[model samples]
Target: MTTGPSGSVLVLTNPDDVTTDLVLRILAERRVPVVRLDPGTDLHAGAALTAAYGTGGQRGTLRTASRELDLTLVRSVWTRRPSPFDGPPELDGQERRFAASQALWGVGGILASLSGAHYVNHPWNNRAAEYKPAQLATARHSGLSVPDTLITNDPRQAREFAALHAGAVVYKPLWNTPYAVDGRAQQVWVREVRPHEITAAVAACPHLFQATVEKAFDVRLTAVGNRLSAARIDSPDLDWRQRQSLMECTPIAVPDPVARAVCAYLTAFRLTFGAFDFAVTPAGDWYFLECNPNGQWAWQPGPITESIAHAIADQLQKGPEL
Candidate 1:
């Protein structure tokens, strides 16, 4: 698997992430020129400044002034999970300086320099994808079933929504804001909402209450490029993440229409990859919950991981046509 003409690709990521390792493995197996930007001292501001900023930002001017320097071009860059210094105390003042400089100069500057890079998922795109309400609208437009949802801070509206769903409503946070007080990972799950609970729920923060579908199985559909992989996650719990041991996840193929909807949602978000959560009823109804652009996929089984790696590498080596 030799890359004929595609030049080197610089993957901006931490050395520790399994996704990074998986991508690097794919590129290496294909004999693709891959440069890794890892954690720590490597992020120090030097070379780029020496080139982009050095000699008053002019290579031709330096030559005219009798200064020697070599000008090289960056073909492409892939900004994966950017690695920055961990603890502030672990790094010295200068090291901290380098990290700050890197954000503005190293990370920010390098990405600014490159004209185009096949971003598997760009930062701004990820930002847009995080909007759950927006994703819900997009999913509905793509012919996917979405549960009736009501988002408001009014207590009366909340009570009415719960009454409509007949106490079969679920209250969910718009975002996952987890904090560790001791060593415990306190997860917030969408629990069954009672009409009496609506008053407090509305007081929380613009409650996003939805009709809790009696799900036959929860589906986590991961889409990498045009390749789609589905997993049927069965758990007795409403939110499977709360009780991992009770859940069973098996790889499965999505229906053609459902697959198309997933791809359409990805396109709407301008994302190359997405992890979509769906609720399937006993009637075989697939309801769109949300799609996370930077969702976790490494924990998935080998086949899924391999396919994802292939999709990413194919896109990087070839083009979007892959």
Candidate 2:
């Protein structure tokens, strides 16, 4: 195998991710060595990795179609939205399952174990931060105001909570998953819930309910390293995502307290990057909604998008100090 360059940046994400594309472009301009690999699809399609560890410490090499990477020389890793591992088409269901599991434990573990590589929010940390309950609690602990919330599988508790909020609560899914209706893609958007709507079916699964905030607008704060880029989102819909085309996005300065709290939240999760959502009240209170550890920032309007991309590239280029 040919030797790859030292101090390479390893980017793990799907090919179609425009956000990754922007950062890659900046890295290219800066002449930084980057090896972009989608472990899910590339592993079985010409990509290869070999790792070994003893008293001498870990050593490995990963090869893609056009670039070879010295695993030990990797300076940083971006664990973005990589696809799931898949086996060859010829493999039967059981065999495919086995192969995928092996790839996940073997390949995934090695990538996670890269020594001295700065992670823009490691995959393990991302998984931990994905839990909404943990997010709400962490936000609260970090001195950020979080809406009064409830998570329950009991119908009685659900009804009581809604009644307690005077039926001004909104129901949000505990997590987002691939959902469709009659072949059309569907999303579970936050919607108002009434006490009378609480049914026995709620007992089937845990549900998240929060008292709706009286908001003037919303904020999408993208954090890379110590830098933050925030945008004010104004929309008529309760969920801004539902009417993104109708929404207006303008650059906004993050409140000092909110910025400090966000940094604390990232430190709490051991994350170097996070995309935080906040509901800003007319009275100037910012209510913590959620934080997407590996959220998209390139979609933001104006210079905020490029600013965020530059910040991300800067982190990857610098990596971690050995």
Candidate 3:
């Protein structure tokens, strides 16, 4: 597990993801040796009875971690993905819960044994960054403008906020939980909210209603260490995800103030990586929306992916000066 003259990175991720594939490729190109391991397999139990099912979707297994795969030598770990477990149907619901609890407890124990290693963005840091309200407040505190926002479970309050904002509010899910029952994908969009729709939207959860700025364009800022890259994303539709094909992204210079704010946000969150989304108003104002710590960057257009890969490698190899 010792790192060679060339530093090593352990990418703990699922086998079937574009993120892992892209990272592996980039690391190889830079001659940064990496080992990919499934967290589930690495944390498996030896004496525990386990059952494997299904071919490709998911598999439940009974296995154990080897002594050699100990956490001490792990110089850096990218907690990209962890596999899901499905136990045997024959086991009662309570039995399944007991087994799952045991697995998690074991995994926790293993993690507790580790001396700290540099995580590109640790899971806990990512979790803390996921809260939109926190992101907005942090951004504003760091000298970035942020749109007025409201989060409440009350339909009446939401409707009132929408009306006060001249129906120029947008709704976004607090967390990324995209689900589909069948093959079709469920659509979620960010657009001008109607006061009348507030009643129905409140039934789901506390809605995050915000004043929708009149955006001339959108920006995705990928911050790796102190280095940052801003891309201007222009789309025909209100939500960029909807008209992705029509969207054109180009490298743009981030204002010094904005770049400094981003660096502050990163330091505040103790994160080495972050993907920040901003709403650029027609008035030339950039309003901070949210930051995703474990955000998707490989799919970012053009040299963005390459830039991030190099940035990450630089930090690992040069001892975090950047």
Segments of candidate 3 deviating more than 4 angstroms: 1-7, 29-31, 41-67, 85-92, 179-185, 200-204, 318-322
Q: List the residue pairs that clash in candidate 3.
A: none
| Lowest-sum lDDT 10-residue window in model 3 | 58-67
Model 1 lDDT, residue 174, Cα: 86
Give me the displacement of residue 67 in model 1, in angstroms.
23
Candidate 1 vs 2: which has more TM-score: 2
TM-score for each model: 0.81, 0.96, 0.82
Q: For model 2, what is the error of residue 79's alpha carbon versus the real structure, in angstroms, after optimal superposition?
A: 1.1
Q: Give a tens-digit lDDT track for model 2, residues 147-250.
A: 99999999899899999987769999989988999999999999999999989999888999999999999999999878999999999999999978999999
Residue runs of model 2 more than 4 Å from their true location after superposition = 1-6
lDDT of 3 by residue, 206-253 (tens): 788899888899999999888898889988887887878889898888
Clashes of each: 0, 0, 0
**Cα lDDT over the full model 2:** 0.90
Cα RMSD of all models vs. native, in order, equals: 5.6, 3.1, 7.1
User: Measured by TM-score, how close is model 3 to the native structure?
Assistant: 0.82
Question: In lDDT terms, which candidate is top?
Answer: 2
Q: What C-alpha lDDT do the candidate models reach, one value each?
A: 0.72, 0.90, 0.72
Candidate 1 per-residue lDDT, tens place, 1-322, comes to: 3454455666667656667788778778888776665423343422232335575553311121222223233334455776644423457778867656655544454453444456667667877889878988999998889999988888888888888876668888888887566988777787888888665546667778898887899999988877898888998889988887889888987988898888888888888878899999999889999898878777677888778777777766763232
